[model samples]
Structure formats: C-alpha cells, structure tokens
Target: MNKIYTGILSAVCLDGSPPAYHYAKGFGEGASNWMVYLEGGGWCKSEDTCYSKVQNQGPGMGNSYKKGNQTAFDGILSPSQTMNPNVKIHRRGARVFKAIMEDLLAKGMRNANNAILAGNSAGGLATILHCDGFRALIPNAARLKCIADAALFIRGKDLPGAADKRELSFATIVAFHGIDNFLPKSCTSKMDPGLCIFPENLLGDIQTPIFLLNSAFDSLQVSSCFFQNLLLELNSYILCIHFRTTLLKTIPEDHSSSRGIFIDSCYYHDQIYFNPKWIGPTSPKLNNKTMSEAVGDWYFDRSSFQEIDMENDFPRDCTRDT
Candidate 1:
C-alpha cells in the first residue's frame, strides 16, 4: 500500500506531537482496495490535552475518563476504562480529515478497485463531508463504501461546499449512534431545535445501503431515531437497525462520547456527568459488534454491495440549491 501525508489548515497536535497517517499495506499487495477512518470532536490540539481537558471538565461534559487511563470506553455495561495506550491518537479536525483524504488520493488510493470510508463520532461526520471530493478524485470503477459508528445527524449545508457538492453516492453506507447523546454542535445550533437542515438536503440523493444503531437507554438514541425518520420519509434507500437495548451506556457525557475514547483522565466536575457503566471495548468487534462486523465485511468484499447512479437521484449542486 502506498501512503502520503496531506497537511490540513495547520498541523494536528496529538499528545503534543504532529499528526500522522498509517496506510496499511494491502490494496497494491493484491487487488487495489482502500479504507479510511475518521474520528469525532471539535478539532482538539492533541489527544492527551483533549482528554486532560475533558478530565478537568468532569464526566458529564462529554469527556468520560476511566480509572485506568484509557482513552475510550467499552460499549458494554461495565465501567468506562482507558483506551489502548499503544494506539496512536490522531487529531480530530475537519481540515486534518480533508488533508488525509487528499493525501490518500495523491498516493493513488482513488485508483483502487474498492474504497471504504469509516470513522467513529466526528470522524464519521468527516467521512460524509469529504465523500464528494473522493468521488471527484477517484476513478469510476473504484467502489466506495462507508462505515459510520455512532455517526449520522450531520447536515451537508454545514460543510464548506456542501451547498454545491453532491451527496456521497457510495456503494454502501452504514451508520451507528448512541441512544443517549445529541447531535454534535457541528450539526445544529442547539439540541432541541430538531434535525439539521443539511442531512435533509442530501437524504433523497443517498443511494447507498445504510445501517443505523442506537440504544433505548441512550439520550442520543432519540436523535438517531429522528435521523432515521427523516431518511425513511425521504424515501431513501437506507437499511437501518436500531438497538433499543444496551448493556452499557457511553461515558464522557458530552455530545462526542465516542470521540473522547483516548483520554487518560477526567476532571472531577466532568465525572459527575459521566456514566461509569460506559466502557471502551477491548477489541473493535466488542465496541459495537453489529456495526464493527458489518464494516469489516464490507471493507474486504466489494462485490456484495451496489453503487449509486448519481445522475438520476442526486442534483449536481444540491448543496448550493438548498
């Protein structure tokens, strides 16, 4: 696999270090295939600092800190724990995401036979926002696949050129969201006002297969439900599965629950708002079994999915028209 680094608005500061990308060797090893992962949050300077601030703020502020210094919490009913210490935390910023995508394309990722875009939380939103650019940069034969965990509820209008860019017309689009959290600030001005207008604008044009996940016990689940409702109403070709039951609740009590999975500590005040039962999974499979499994399967096998015909379903520049 070929790898390249694209600079975002500025360099990402993770644990006080610059951001970097790891392109796994595969696509070029056999047949060409590509997979990209995005993370959630409002573009923190560094992973450690981001977590430290959350810890300082306390649990309820959306930054849950497990006792073990884990950055992520398990999706199970147990108390939240620390993320993998060895795992490299990338800067979660929109510009960083754009740079990554651009870098991948520059490295010939766009020419692959298959492509997959995956992310948790804000990263998921970034994938959706950057899909159009991927389409423009890659060859037509390259299949596009998306795996969004606790994602969706994003509005295309919020993106830089969402007004003019087309909704991501991928072969498959899968999304997941917690039942307790609300849409991120990027999605709306306030939590109560309702759905972001951006998702509405692109709903009709999305032709990929969509999978939805939510827990009944989670507050964010309500927002996921609202998102599902809008997609269904738009007569979209989305496949949604909602988990009304959950054994655990996510921690760090903020809108970007999954995004804060890498912090080492939480502020005392934030702890009051955190749900101890929310823990990060030991493996990606355990995080959210259904979504993780589906994503893995999609990433390897492109033949199982079908691509969208952009000309008929989506407007050339719906973002601008909306």
Candidate 2:
C-alpha cells in the first residue's frame, strides 16, 4: 500500500483526483489468498454523461477525494475466518486496475497462493475483459480465477431490425474513453474493438476460469414499464421475453467445462457479496445453493454450478428487506 503514487502512474480519476481502495490483509489459514474486487459504477458513454455525473455526484464516483478512508468489509471480503473469505473507479479504470495490482503485488499479493478477480456490473465486464491478463500477472500463484456478476450485457436485436442501444452505448464509451487499446486482442483481431467489449464476444477466448452470476431478467438491461395502452404493454412484454431468450442462448454451451454459471430469474442487478442476497435464506437459489455458496463451491473446486432458471420466464423479486 506504500511507495506507489497516483501522480507517478497517472492513474488519476476523470477529474484528475487520486484513486483509492479499501484493503484488509487476510489472516489465519486464509493468508496468502487474495480476492481482487472491481467496484462497478456503470460507465460514462459520452462527454455529457460524464459531465452530468460530475455535476450530480461530485467526484465521489470518479475521484478518490470523496471516498471514505475506510470501508466496512463484509460478506466475501470480510475478515471473519469462520464465515469465509476474500476480497473502484474511473473512465481511466483500465489504468487504475494496473496500478492497483502493481501496488498489491508490492504489498504481498505476489505471494498469493490463491486468487479470485471479481466484479459487478461494469466492473464484472472489466473482470471478464482483464481475466487473462490478470492471470499472467501472477504466474506463480497456484490458483487464479475470475467472477463476473451481472455484467453479461449481451448484444442482440430487440426487435426484427432494431438497433441495439447497449451496443451503441459501448461504442460511444470506447470512443469517449479511448480504451480501444485495452480491449482483448483475441476479440479485436476478429472484429471491431468496440464489439469486443461485450463479454459474449470475449468469453470464448478467455483462458482463466470464470464464474458468471447474473439474472436472466437483469433489472438494468430490462426495465418495468407502466403503459396505458394495452397493446403497447403487451408488445413490451413480448420484447422482454425475447431479450431473456437471447441472453440464455448467448451464454456459450460450456464446451470447455471451465465456466460456472448461475443465471436466476431474479429482478436484480448486482448480487455478489451483499449478506442477504449472497447467502441468506431469502437469497435467490438455484439447485439449493445461494449465490455465495455456489461461488465458494466453484472457487474451491467443490462443485461446478452452471444452472439457469428455466422455470421462470419473468423476473421474480428476490431482494431482501434488510
């Protein structure tokens, strides 16, 4: 955590504020095991969006100046040995990723025996994007894997010939962030770098094992509508069904046997490490295992979880009150 400066690495935020992170060294038997979590705060596809974000949120999301000096660690990143173990920023996120890992290696991640790179939403996409590169960074580590939670933003036709807003947004983000160079060459070599940002386009080539925790009816990608016209509402419902089907089919057939999938029919976005959604009874379950249980089982090689919620065609409310 020392001897590395944001100014030296130029890993500053969009507003040029210094980047920051909350890290707790693992203790007891879990020492030498590392979990690198990339916090997701969506993306800024254009200059206007970025500007609007700055206006509304100050530099909190894009700058470390507003971030708390210490963040509470719970769930997977928790220091509780009995419960279990593990565990931000910028359009300059790619740069920040590199700098953080460099610092962690200097701080002892280089000695890591087991490592998991996990992220949610946009950060989950980042996990998939950088999985292989992260593996290469620690070749000596005995075990390394990645997890992408609710980041499987697919590219597909909403209607017969409708333009995909998600894909267009990604293209704009590429142009806005100038992050084309950071995209995986395996994907870029085959098509436009902008298309490569989609996880579906890049998953086929990823060497590192990855576990995907997502929802068939992802709340972010699919929205609820209150239409007065019955026909319009019916049309919207049909589109939702098509979207769900497209997402299911887009996930590869798991030919390599290295992918761990858990796509429930929940109306949630990011559901990785939060206590209730992660491990409690109210948490959405597939094959009798909660998200946290499934992830732990996959990470430790206890079992391979690759089940989709075929029963529910609609998104079920799985959020907990607490």
Candidate 3:
C-alpha cells in the first residue's frame, strides 16, 4: 500500500481543500486487475456545511488520525483491513475522486485486464456520476464496471425534505461539486441541474456496467422516528416499501434480465463498505448468499443473482421495524 499525494493539482477537493487518495497495489493473481474505490462520506448541501465538514475531518487524518494504520481499506476496497464506521468524513469527495482516477491513469492502470470502480454512500453516487469517464479512460480493459453501495438516495419530488427544500439542497450540491456538468445530457437537456443530478432520474442513462449494492431498507432515507410514526398509523408501511421498490426500478431492463443485485432486507445503509454488516453467519442474507458472494459472482460473472430479500424472506415492513 502506498499513499500518493496527487501531483495533478488542477482537481481540488469539494470544499477547495487539498485532494488525495491512498493506493494499494494489486499483486500476483490480482495484478492485472484494477479496482479503484472511491471513499464515501455524505454530501454537504451548502458551502457552510461543506466548510464545517472539512474542519472536522482534516484533523482525523492529521496528528491523531494514525500514521501507523497504513491498511485503511475495507470490504471490497481492500482485502486486508476493515474500516471503522466512525472514521472522519472528507467533504472534498469529487476532487479527490478525479485526482485518484487521473493519477491511476498516469501510472498504467489502463493496461489492466479489467477494472472495477466502486464506492460507498456518497462515494457510491460519485461512482455513478463518473462511470462513463472511468470507462473512457481505459477503453481497452476487458471489462470496466461500477459498484455503488448504499448510494441510491431518493431525490426530487419523492425526497423526504419535500420539493422546495429538496431543490435547494440538490442545487447546492450540484454547484458545490460541479455535478451538473457531468450529468447525462439526456437528463440535463430536459431537466434543470437540480433534478438531473438525482440518480432515479439519471441512472437510466449510464452505459457502463453498474451493480448496485444497497439495502432494501436503507435507514438513512428516513429517520427512525418518522418511520415509527408511519407504522403506528399504517400497519403495513406500504408507502415506505413502495418508495424503496421505486429506487430499485432504476436498473435497466437489460441488467434486470441478466441479474446482478445484492439488495437485502436489512435496516442499514452501507453493508458492503464495512465488514460487520456484510460478513459472518448472522449477517443479513439474501437467498442464503452474503453480500460479498453476490458482488463477487456479479463482478466476475460466476452466477446470475437477482435477490430482493424484501420480496422473499422478509415480510413487508419487517425491515422498517428492524
């Protein structure tokens, strides 16, 4: 594992801070494969929030953040170590992502046998937004795919914040991260920047092979108190399940036909990014397959898997209560 401070400085952090990423060189059987994982931290809706995020995260990587813990990779990012969920959040996501991919290209990543661009949470969304650019950079690779973990957040009219607030929040992120410029032209040409950045509206346009690794019951979408209130009145919480179902509907018809999903009936956000939620006998299971098994099978094409635990093992709203 090596830490590379990007020499290409044009790409700065999301908050105008310095951009950087840690690299773990693949070896032996994996040497010919390139896996670029974008670190995930939730996005900031405004300059004020972005600034605050930087201040909190900057120190975690500094004096107290641990110069000794070199193996920071977790889940699919690296096979060596597990990431602590409490790790500091870096708000300069878009800049750091661009810098890393650019740096990798300069270092011969394009010659790899195949490539996997994966991310968690907000980084998952970044993976979606940058899927095409990644493939184009290494068009010669045998296969180039993208994986997004717990990144499918509901946006637009369906967002919990309502239309007006959602518009302001999305607009701020687009301006803050310069996301509008990368949005699929098909979406942006018809919708405003705010609406175009939402995945539900834009995922249909992504051409690169993508595998969504998220939970059917992503707790972050709605607060627990709110969900509990809904259950108190609506015995089934059908509305919540319906919303979750719609998010999965973003997958293309072709992908759906082939089968590459690990969505489960877990009340968590990002299981693939952390070990505890993804591994072990007691972990959430879909058709008896763990998160890693499903992802591996899909990325390597070992098996055809399309699992929606909500529809099979778990009863409707069972996850909402869990």
Candidate 4:
C-alpha cells in the first residue's frame, strides 16, 4: 500500500477567523503529485451534528450568537437561510479560502504537479470557484479534479470565470446526490434571482470525464439528470452513473435519529456520501457515506486509472456553445 502523510492548514477567512483544510502529504508523493480537497461551504466545521453543537455551544463562540450574550439560541442561523441580508459577507469566506489555498501551493506545502482539486457540497462549489486562482498561482500543468456531492448553488451570475480558465485541465468531475433533495429548492425556481444556477450552467464548461451518481428517491437526482442530459446533448465528455435505491423513511418518535436527519440534510450541506453497509443496514434511513469513497469509486471505475491526462482544455461551450 502507498504510505500517506496528512497535514492540516487553517485558512483565516475575510471574517479573520481561520477555516481548515485537511492536506494529505502522500498523494502522488512518489511522482511529485498532489491533491487539494476543499470541504463544503456550509457552516465550516467537521462534526456530524454541527448545528446541534452550535446550539449546545450556545452561540457567541462561533457566530451562532453575538459575543457577550447569554441566551439559549436556535442553531439554524446560516448566511443562506437568514434574512439579515449581507451577501458579500458570505462570499468573503470563499475568497479567503482561495487565498489560503494559493498561499499553500506557492509555499510548496502543496505540490503543484499532478494536483487534484476536490470538494463536496459548498466545498465542491468552491473547487470550481477557485480553479482559476489555482492555475494563476501554479502555472505548471496540474490535474484539476472534483467530487461534488449534491452541490449546485450559485451566488451570482452563472457564467464561468477565472475558475474556468482554459489552461487548466480536469482529470474528472464526480458529482453525487439523492433524488428528493439536491440543491436548495430556491436555486431551481426561476422566481428567485439570488438562488444559485451555476451547477446547471457548469455542464458545458466541463470538458473532461464526468461521473454523476444519484439515488432514485432523491430530488437532487432530477437536477443531476438535467445537467447530464445537457452534457449528452452537446456530446461533451461526461460519464454519468445513477444509483437507484429507495430512501428509508425515518420514524418521527426517535429524537437521536431526528438529530441525525438534521445533520445529514442541513449542517453538512448534503455532502454525506457513504455506503449503506458501513453505516449498517438497521438505520437505512440515515445510512450515509463520505465523498471520499464516492470519488475513489469513480476514479477506479475508469479504464485509464493509472495514467493522468493533462492535455485536455476547458470546454469551449461556456464561450462559444452558450
């Protein structure tokens, strides 16, 4: 087995508080290869029940409440779901994350050659957002990749920008989701302007091999199919896989399980991509997997798993075809 070493880097967002990235040292170590895995953009924390933690922590500590206040607060406060209305504040976090990633790559802590850029949910969106920034910082040819799990929200215009730079080549993009839910419903509705549409618009910009996984019962599956059809229509190089399964219904009486539902659906931003076996068959309703497993499966399933393709250019559909 290939030996792997891991390091964690904390990036201070525009808010000045640091967010972290788990950087693995041994990825492509033998051949000077590297990969960057960006976490999703929901409240940036790594725990199963982040919202509950926020509620238990009782605000003030991490934006759940104003500092110096003492009150039992509802833990559902988020930039997206809130009406206070400061859109730029939310974007600031993404910019800070990009800055930190660039700094790490330039400092040689992250290898530029054979680098795989990846993320789930909001993290997946960030991967696409930061693609151009990564290229500008590291001019050397590197393999850019992603594993976006049910992440299709767009904050602003749906057009591809620096992240879609032509110089960068995608190794593959593996997107996963359930059917009943994918991105927030607001994003899909034409009535809402602030909602995201980038996920749908991104289909044409993706030029490399693409794999999409979806559950039959998931609403996100519908959105995934929409994008897949778009790619198929254009004859783009995208490979889609659908995992058809019935979602287990949860019992309302179970409190512990109710918390789990909130964790899976809300806090993590729907990045949970796990196998049903590991989570156990008993809790089929809550059995979930991580993005890592899904991405690994996609790569291994490919015919040319051993070699990396660096010559492919960004799809011109974003410019000419659109």
The candidate that achieves the highest TM-score relative to the unseen native structure: 2
Arranged by TM-score with the best first, the candidates are: 2, 3, 4, 1
Span of 10 residues, lowest total lDDT, candidate 1: 264-273
Score residue 280 of candidate 1 by CA lDDT.
Answer: 27
- Cα lDDT tens digits, model 4, 73-106, are 4355533323232321211343345555665665
Candidate 4 local Cα displacement, residue 317, angstroms: 37
Error of 3 at 134 (Å): 0.8
Candidate 4, position 227, lDDT: 44
Q: Which of the numbered candidates is closest to the native, going by highest lDDT?
A: 2
lDDT by residue (1-322, candidate 2, tens digit) is 2223578347766544556678899999889999999878787777666655654554324332233345488778755422351112246766767888999998899989999899998889988988998899889999899999998888764433224466676888888888888887778889887788888798888889999999887777766211123324565666667778988877877755478999998877888867778877678889988888888888888888888889987767886542
RMSD in angstroms, all models?
Answer: 17.6, 10.0, 8.9, 17.6
Q: TM-score, each model?
A: 0.40, 0.84, 0.77, 0.41
Please list the residue runs of candidate 2 whose C-alpha ends up more than 4 Å from where it truly belongs after superposition: 1-4, 58-91, 158-164, 224-236, 320-322
Error of 2 at 168 (Å): 1.7
The alpha-carbon deviation from the true structure for residue 35 of candidate 1, after best TM-score superposition, in angstroms, is: 0.3
For model 3, name the residue pairs that clash: 14-92
- Candidate 3 stretches with Cα past 4 Å from truth are 1-9, 14-17, 58-95, 156-160, 224-239, 250-252, 255-259, 312-322
TM-score (C-alpha, index-matched) for candidate 2: 0.84
Error of 1 at 302 (Å): 9.2
